[model samples]
Target: MTDTPENGAAAPTAAPQITSRVLAQYIRDMSFENILAQKGVTGDAQPEIQVQVNLDARKRSTDNQYEVITKLNITSKTKEKGDPLFVLEIEYAGVFHVEGVPEDQMHPYLLIECPRITFPFLRRIVSDVTRDGGFPPLNLETIDFLALYRSELARRAESEKAKAN
Candidate 1:
């Protein structure tokens, strides 16, 4: 605790310190499909890619640690035929040791921070797998975890308010 010069009262304590360590991370599932090879679609055109992401976290009953999973699905297809070009799906998970976060903030910390720590590894895997699967390496864009968390919170609040109404 630090003392203030002007007032005789002591200053407030520091904010709660939060620390996170990744215990382990692994690929729970992975799939890379080159639809052009399977369907023999001849095309020299660049395919439009679409990516989707999902996050889930749960507390382990045994050790009180948290397990966070980040799921990503990427698909590319032509504009005219809408035929599939390539599909890549990955489910990456990590065990995180989180300390000093308050109960009210724990959920967001686990969902956002833990995944933020583990996403680079998942991104690398996606790139490597696509290149190995005979296609150009697919470099994914960086994600905004904080925006996602805030949006999720707002959506939930709106849903509850609707139910109450």
Candidate 2:
């Protein structure tokens, strides 16, 4: 038995279903510089690593398609003397076909959800690059996309406010 309206009628509205598919993913650009190897640094030296991440999203010529690019700049140096160790820069991009998301939410969906879907592959590449460059594998911690999105929005707001002043 189903609960019906007082007049014995059924509900007429349902929410739209959201669907997303990854059409393709690739490394758009990458560069790894082994500064330590180039400088010939020897004798057990400590390593300090820094990583920076940036994101961009743009619409494709095709309908319902968008491209999201994640850019990472990584550097490693010796903790003791602050000598250079290695630097890795990479841009990874994904093509997604998305449907049913509201227009207002498309930006966040593209920046956050799409990157979250493709992050594992990016992580693997970073780890492999570091290991192959003669250092231990560098495993990155999980990123909080929601927090990142909010921070970026706040930054843009401040920039616009300053420009107006």
The segments of candidate 2 whose C-alpha lies over 4 angstroms from its true place after superposition are 1-12, 42-44
True-structure Cα RMSD, model 2: 2.3
Across residues 38-105, which tens digit of lDDT does each residue of candidate 2 receive?
A: 88676667888899989999999999999999999998888878888999999999999999999999
lDDT tens string, model 1, 1-165?
Answer: 556856677777999988878889999998888888888676664678899988999998756489999999999888767888899998999998888999998998888888899988988998898888888888888999999889988999999999999
Each candidate: what lDDT?
0.87, 0.93
Q: Top model by TM-score, which number? A: 2
Clashing pairs in 1: none
TM-score of each: 0.90, 0.91
Which structure among the candidates has the greatest lDDT? 2
lDDT of 1 at 61: 75
Model 1's alpha-carbon lDDT is 0.87
